[model samples]
Target chain A: MVKEKEHEQDAEAGSYPTGQKPKYGPFDIRRYSPTQESKEKRKSNVLFFVALFAIIMLAVYGWYWYNTPGGERQVVQLKNALAPYNPATWYMGKLSQAQDIGNVWSAGGGNETLKGVLFDSFKVAGSEEIPQGSPVVFAYGLKLANAVVSKLPLTLSCNIKDKDIAGDIIPSNPLIISGKRITQNARCRFNSEITKELSGTVEVEGGVIFPFSTTDAKLKVYFTSEEMEQSLLSADEGDFFSYLGIDEQLPLRTAYNGEPIELGIGVSTENEQPVVLREGYNPLIGITLNNRWDGKMLNLTEFRLIIPKELSINQEISQNPNGLCPFTLARQGKTTNEYRASEELIEQVSLEKGRLRSFECWLDVAPELLGSAQYTVKEYEAEADYVYQLPSRTATITVKGVAGKETGIGEDLLSPLV
Target chain B: MGIKPIAIACICLVSLFFISGCDMLPNSIPGFGGNDESSVGGVLSASIFAPSNNGKVLSDYPFKPIVKIKNAGQFEAEGQTCITGLDKDVFSVFTGCECKSFKFEKEGATSEFEPISLEFGSYTVKPQEGDANQQFSAITRYEYVTDVTADLCISNDIYEDCGADPDAGGAIDAKISRVSGGPISIEGVQETVSYTGGSDTVTLIFTINARKSATGRLIPESDLNAQCTPVSADETPKVQAAVREFPITTPIRCRDAEVSADSTATIICEAKDISLINAKGQAVFEKGYTVPITFSLRYFFETVASSKFVVS
Candidate 1:
């Protein structure tokens, strides 16, 4: 009766009845239930873990944002700090006063001839070698296009800083005649003459060599550009003297030994040509200042271009057999190295007897129009005492080589090696 | 046992400190003024009596030496008149020509120039940090750039050569024989012509650098305390002036130079090359005159300052 009573009590407590397997399962699948305190404790434990994870994640991301390395953007790469980007100014050089040189006039359709001046012809900066049969040209004031000739007897010359490289300065009895076509008249649209002119072709047949660059390297290096263009639409030396404020058509004047009276920027119709400050006299362009590195633009701080009177090509003509000795030059556009000329003009120019000289060239003529105005040219004389001043230039590159045994702190610097 | 809760408590404490300590905004340093930039260690000043690039500072190494030209009379300003000596076009001004004439009125509005650009530079002093009373700060130096340029134009005015500082250029013309008796002179009326008596503008640049000071070093410009000395903080540089004739004997004509034809027929005017230093303290001008132009009446000349030079 006790066993029966105990069994009945267990069954009433909701457990599977000890002898009730005949109809259903003997045990309940559900596990034991927790007390109220235990349930609350479990909830708190889960909350603590979530909070801890969030704190750690925030720290890691914050650290990465401040200390991560990349380009200039990241904190570790922010070495070029922005203390203050206050840029100061620098004084480059000063300019001289402006002087009136000459004027320009709209001439006619006949071939044109420029006869102003070849103030000075100087070779500045490092020089290069002209190989045998190689096309060569000299760029000088006013007639820079005609300055360099081809098909000439080759002459060897070299240039370097302070005479490191030397070549024959000028060979005795040396004359080179490269058969470059010579034509006149084809000035710009405003200065063109009415007719085409002819330039005869010949070879001066002598060897003259310019062995060195400017003798005095201290001859203030002007910011000059010999960076020639494969594209040559205009033969304006003004591009070379871009550092100089003078333009291609701007007249050059003289300051030293110039007519006592200094002329200014003016023009007049004296010889049918509208000239800048023309007064029946040879005008000059003088350097207005001496000191360089002033804080002004287009500063003539270092040098100036002075036109020479003796070098005037437009002098009165006296009829002669060698009318315009370099006939190619008289016929304006007839003489051009722009295109590969006829083989006669583009003939091979090679060195002989260890010197390159004499070559063939064309001299243009204006027989049809300038019969009465036929002119003769004086001997081609370069200014013996003149020297050209090129502008100074520099390029800074961060050189990186082997640091060797003496590695220093700077990116490209190194300490003394043992 | 208490690791999680302890971590949470630590995080809360850290957040409170961060929120309370950081400002994340602009803050001014104590007792500093005029573009003062402060760090945890020191401060940098932008306008600490900024000196000009010209060598016009009163001393070689001024402690906050800044030059300010005030109350200068306005003169006639012509674009072409500024670089007339090169005789070349405005394009010739920069190409490789030297300074013909460099003058600027050091007083008032005439002295002000266009804002120039600055290039990269650096300044430093040995042991830059120290006490003001015990150790004086070492010399500070700055190497900044003041290079600027503008396009030059050709002045085609017919009257450009007639007593005209047209783009600072002139053509040789017949000289003025005599001064017309008038009530005006061309010096101030046409172009301020003052000849420097055997004077040449020799450029001398002075650069002073004020490194990041450890202690707040009192700048002479703004510091006027009991400890301040009688010396002015804004010391004036030694500006030299003189008169002389230029070699440019270009013939110039003064046709109708006088503004009024009826004022004074016997005006006594002297043709001189007036010159002064620009704010940068470089001799800017040395004007040459053909002859003095007399006017029947007084006419003020406008000063030309913006002479665009050709950049080579």
Candidate 2:
């Protein structure tokens, strides 16, 4: 009993029993009342951990902010603000804008001014100075503009003032403009045969007003009798002249300003320049009137032709039932005789705008007048009158010399020619 | 040493809280959240993406026509598509329906998806002796609505800074807003204001023009399924226009709402006896009130695309 009481007293006094030892070391006890070094170490660890945590939090917040929509928008704004300072970006932006505008225009979405029929370009595809008896090519282009839509067909017509030169237009008859096509090109070839040097203009007229009317549409050309046969044989054969080295000479010409109405007279004989009068040969005289006005058509009221007294109208040749000029002749004076056009002829023939109307008559020389001479020369006058009260225009004709006898003229003169 | 594990655990808990907090903020905000009703701006664009121009197809063989329709605008469109300009004798459609129906969801919305492709039924080329080329047009007809918002200055004084001049009368800028992208657009706006003894009247004119490229005809909105057929040249298309919102007590009236042959239309709206007073019966003279005027135009629009191909 005394020993048990002593053990209890020892345990109460915090002493281990007999040979038992404490499970902890001296350092464990020191942890309860830490020394300055240990406390300082603990404080330093806490400080390091706090700093680490702060850095990690900062990184996380930064990543979150950068990925946000508002943050991305801010960055985009900064980049845009700096874009103008960079010349390359500025130029690229301008180039893209210009390309967009060009694309819009190509799609026919812009430019209100280009909304009607437009006269695009006019060019003479051949030489400006053409050789006589050679073909001359005139090429012109017309645009229906960008947005002009037409359900009905629009017609285009062109006329050259000189009647002696004639050929087929590429798109003959009515030049119809239809469908969604915006452009049309036309070619006019004139095979000109001339007795003398000539300079004339070809008038083009579109039946519309404004753009078509405002265009000059006249092409002036010169013809020379030199090297006629050689040039005609060597003329370029195609729908259009070759554009190889000739591009430099094909620049568009300036606009023309002149009268819209013109008149020309041509005389053809069986023989060459110096004519020969025989039993069966007669001269054909043609008078051409051109109405270059594009606005409306003009009516014919009267037409009269006067010939030299040495020659008279061939009744069989000039008075054909289906002829263009059927006339009644009256002796005016000793020098000439006047022939008046019939009422049916005046009423049936009306000159259309931008077109030509021709009045032809045949003249026969009296065999008695050509007596005893190698040849004889004569001069005469021709005049015309219109119903629209246009001023009367006149032309002079000079027939060089006519051989008197059939034997005096060559075999070429005996054949029919024009 | 014993405190190290607790410190690491606390740090991990704090990091997790921050990462999770960011995702939760967007859901809590009212207007910032994305919804199915949100809209950007634009209209449906259609293009024939298959069978390239001048492509050759074998005679007596079946071929399919594919159209790409994209809903790039704000409105959900449901329309019918038809193929025209094809010779009935040369080509035969094997499908049961002449015109097929298509539906597309609006863009910039939560339910938006990629552009939907529409495929017409198989077409067989009829046998012919010689190869020939023919032009065919693809037409899409849909009922569409265009909305326009404009702000006009309502002032009792003519010399106010509402872009008005006393010597030249009261003519102000309409301050028209940008129209939503579509086949039709408002070209110009003109406004005129005249003052009476105690009130003022304003006149507004709107000029609208249709896109020239790939745009066909426009008709009235009533019975669109019945009127979406081919239109004659002499028949003029009509649009139903309404003044949805105006600040004045008097109702606004519009006139001359017909599309002309040039693909342009003019609508003139007038408001009579407009008093420049607030709800409290106070005059707004020194500072003019900017009244927002809204217009809604409903019409059925048709667009056509054409291509030429040879059938050998």
Candidate 3:
């Protein structure tokens, strides 16, 4: 009983293992501390919020890019790639804002025509500074986009705008639409593959060209079937509408693709001053070679000068040249002469960028017997045939209001070089 | 940045570059044939009609036939002139005096004219034997001039731009837009003007040759005659001589007419005159006196036609 009493006293005095304090490492003590736990929880919350914000931002950006005008275009491209022949997927990426359009036609076959003609784009390819009337040729191109179609006829007729059909083809009168005359240059094919290709991947091309006039103009094209061609040839406007099985402007329209095509046209002259080649006078035709084209290097082939009969370039103008080209002088009429530049001489004239070439020639002018009422200014067209850096082309320069005399270059003088 | 993030950034930059570059591509894929920008030349198709060709005229002396001009091609006719000259002097008045100019608003349109009738003096008609009909063929000439402007694509590069490809070809430029020339050919005048006279009258048949000279193509007949046919009173009837030198200083004048091309036309001219009784009442001379008279012609003509084309 004395021994038991002593043990209890020892336990009470904290000498036993149960009453002793435990040894603690840095991790164990801090893990249990309220302050350290709170700090760790706060760090975890910050990381989660950052990740969520990043995900939301990415998603929002994706949605925006897919909806905007530019973004929509990308979507169309992707859709077209997936299902090329699907009519619903027909979307020309970019389009033109044109006020005037000629002979609008749809791609669909038969009377149920589609809306608008699809244009890939229109661009100016090149330009030349002519003498007078400041005549400039605007090199342009038109790409007819794909048309949607189901199985229809094997034959398709595509007509380029403003092309006059040879009178020999069909004895038909022109169809006047919107105060403009529409002529047909029909491209008819008798194959189903053509229709498929046209709607699928192929696009029709029209190098629609015109002189730079003061006013902006619209050009047109016509797409029709063999039956439609007959109607166009035989029917008037009312008759045509009746034949087409509809009235009013059909829903047929046109659309374009891609950026506004840039026409690489430029005037090479140092100054904008216009030059007029006068009649009955010898003048130097100076042309500066400026790289104003999308293409490089102009490989000249021929230079032709169409002069009024009133004016004569060296009767031996052909002989007067360096004899570099095989020149020909032909009478366009009793009142005009066609002077053709030699191919050899033209080949020699490599009009490189920053180069200046002068055509030294003599012009003989004769006065009309009855005399012109006034100093009439006529436009003379000078055309040069050349190869652009990539290929060949022709540039025309016009000299305006040139007067000359009939001093006498006649049929006797027209004997081409034997 | 981490490797993955850096890689993503690089990809985004590359994509932007491609998007910009793609815009430069030709509107068309290279393999597809190029556009059909071909232009057809304007053709002038003209047809002529005369009084005899349309219908029979009752008895109207010196009736000029109606002249009609048509624009049969797919182009507009502008500043077009139709000049008609009588080969015979039987008509007191002429058709298409000093030329007539007009315009055709559209293709396949037409213009018509009815010439006036002018005849001098009186004539007697002798009925021909059965089945004999005298239809006089008069001399008519037509000349015209015009100008036209069209769009032409001039490219410094011929092979790639215009000449090489079939679709690249363009219309060759015509230096002289003037369309004045002798459209009349070997066919003599289609109609006739008749002046019948009595037995006392002298019917002078003048066969004038209407040769299309190059000079005539460039100059008007009136101008040529004005320069060549000098006016003179020297040939007027001499009060003493029975027959004075021909009324005009020059009895026959070619009037500056020279043929540049090898071509000729036969023009028939007829004139009737009553017997000339001197102070003494008597016939001037024996009947059937046929004197030859010749007058050459060089016509002046000018006209214009226009066509429009769009090229890209």
Candidate 4:
């Protein structure tokens, strides 16, 4: 009976009576269950395993996120680190007023000497060549040292030494200071006109204090450009004098010396024709004079217009030579037949330096000499004598005469000669 | 084989939950990844200031080097940005770096520009070999963003507002003078007069540059306005060639970009041998008088600079 009870217990526990097969339906499969204590032990083991796995996984992924080679984190770190980048302010040379001193002269003052002009080391910094005709900036730094108790205003000046650079100096601002030490900035726009080296001088002026002396500085350097050399203004030599000197003597007939002046000689008539004289036309000629001396005045004595032998003058052309300043012309000397001008003419007119004066005269052509359709020019030597301060000079002009039919004279003179 | 299907499924689900739960951890945790698109905050500055480049350097010798570090940007924490404060762990740097590591708290803002004495060990150099100089780069990495603007004046009326200081350009006050070449006329003014001075030409200088106040080290990004353009930390401002137009214009072949720390750039436009008749359908500037020139320039400018340096 005890054995039978143990068998029933095993059957109920699903151990199947120590490996005996249980009877089941066609598709049914045999199953087993653990004892209460074993079931509890198994459940505990599963729970422990799950917890352990979770811990291990946490550690692995943690390591991966922390030490991943590259990702958004790296990019962010780089960005932040580079955030404080500073492109340096483009500047050169020391910022002191007296970094370099040049020729400082001081007049007697309460204590300090009034300083002369000073030069500092102000300059542009770089190696890149600037182009000609292109604008470039010449920046510099300045420092002011004031030893006096009162405030002073300073005019910091910059000058481009090379004219070819065509530079225009532009100050960043006026510098007014009362502090012991202060810095100032300035720039110059160098409008380069040539490819040659460029240089400039910077100066500090106008800081005066009774007991304290001020120091000014300037910078000098050659600025190079990459532009091709440009064409320069012509420097041809021309007539340059300061006194009223005769430049050229031109006559209406044949333009004996050069082309006739635009206005007809004497009274300056509009569209005056060629100086060829007919039986009744007036003959006029222009004498051009210029004062080449810059500032000196030219004083004169008596003036004479000598008549040549071929031209017969029975009387003075005019008692008062119109437009011949302060002078009256009249027949003088019977044998020589000279036309002498009044001394007052020379006294009344004085040519200022660089002044241009034109003297035109109207002379009558003897009517008896015009008989042919075209007359050959008669060459004659004429002279103008004048007494100027320090020197008396004579100017001679050749006069050619054309007396004939107006049409025929044009052929010989290449222009109207009446 | 004895395990129930439902129990197995439950175990698998639990495992998956643990694996995916990592995304929920605080960003401060080492393994958790955060949003990649979010902007980072922190301004780091590190640069070399001494031992300027002089074409060549002696080899295998110690040369004086000047290094500097500064907090050029605000520090952001917990979605708040502070200019004067810093984080506890502040910043970390390697000890072996050429420039020694230092903390902002100890160094302070006043000392930001103070140069640190450092030494650079030279290397071999050769002119014939076309060898490059031994470069020294100090990279200060942080997460940051900035906005910058640069104003360029194209017209005469608003030039002062754009960046041109009136008194700064001494004697640059342009006045018309009748030079010998040709006649001159104001764009729309009547009674045109001929220049009688020397040449029939005038030099028109367009002083185009960022405002004097705009040029400097890193400035507050928010201070920028419409005249300014926001540039990435790594970019710089450049003048667009196609958009530049001078009144009596000339070709601008170079200086197309603003220098790193330049306050202004100059463009020279000249009218040479100009004719009495308006050529190019533009009126000539009169002599002995002041004529306003309207200049239009287009440029891209950035106020923020990434880690950068200069040869002393």
Task: Please give, for residues B63-179, the per-residue lDDT of candidate 1 as tens digits.
Answer: 222211111112221111111111111111121111111123334443433211121111111121121111000111111111111111111122332353435433223233332
The TM-score obtained by model 4 is 0.17
Interface RMSD of each: 28.9, 32.7, 24.2, 43.0
DockQ of 3: 0.01
Task: Label model 1 with its docking quality class.
Answer: incorrect
Q: After superposition, how far is residue A280 of candidate 4 from its true place, in Å?
A: 3.5
Task: Write candidate 2's Cα lDDT for B95-201 as tens digits.
Answer: 22245678766455555545766776578878765665554455677876666777767665644557676466566557777454555556655566776545543
lDDT per residue for candidate 1 within A82-119, as digits (tens), equals 31232321111111122212232211122233211121
Tens-digit per-residue lDDT, B144-215, candidate 3: 322212121222232233232434232222122122223222222111112235333323333333343221
Alpha-carbon local distance difference test for all models = 0.22, 0.49, 0.30, 0.30
Worst 10 residues of 3 chain B by lDDT: B236-245
Candidate RMSDs in Å, in order, are 38.2, 42.2, 38.0, 53.3
Where does model 4 sit among the CAPRI classes? Answer: incorrect
- Per-residue lDDT tens digits for candidate 3, residues A212-255, read 10101011111112332332332222332232222224322112
In candidate 2, which residue ranges exceed 4 Å CA deviation?
A: A1-418, B1-44, B71-73, B93-97, B107-114, B127-130, B166-169, B199-214, B220-223, B226-228, B232-235, B247-249, B278-281, B284-288
Question: Which model, 2 or 3, shows the larger TM-score?
Answer: 2
DockQ, cand. 1: 0.00
Please write out the lDDT profile of model 4 over residues A1-418, one tens digit for every residue: 6656665666777765545644442123443555789989999999999999999999898766544323223443454345334233112212232232322111111223212112233444332223223345554443442243245444433333323223344543343545555444445454434322321111111111111211111011011111100100011111111000112122221111210111111212331222244445444433333333222224434444443222343235433454442233356432224554556555554544334445545555543222211111122222333222211111111112233422211134422433
At residue A327, candidate 1 shows an lDDT of: 14
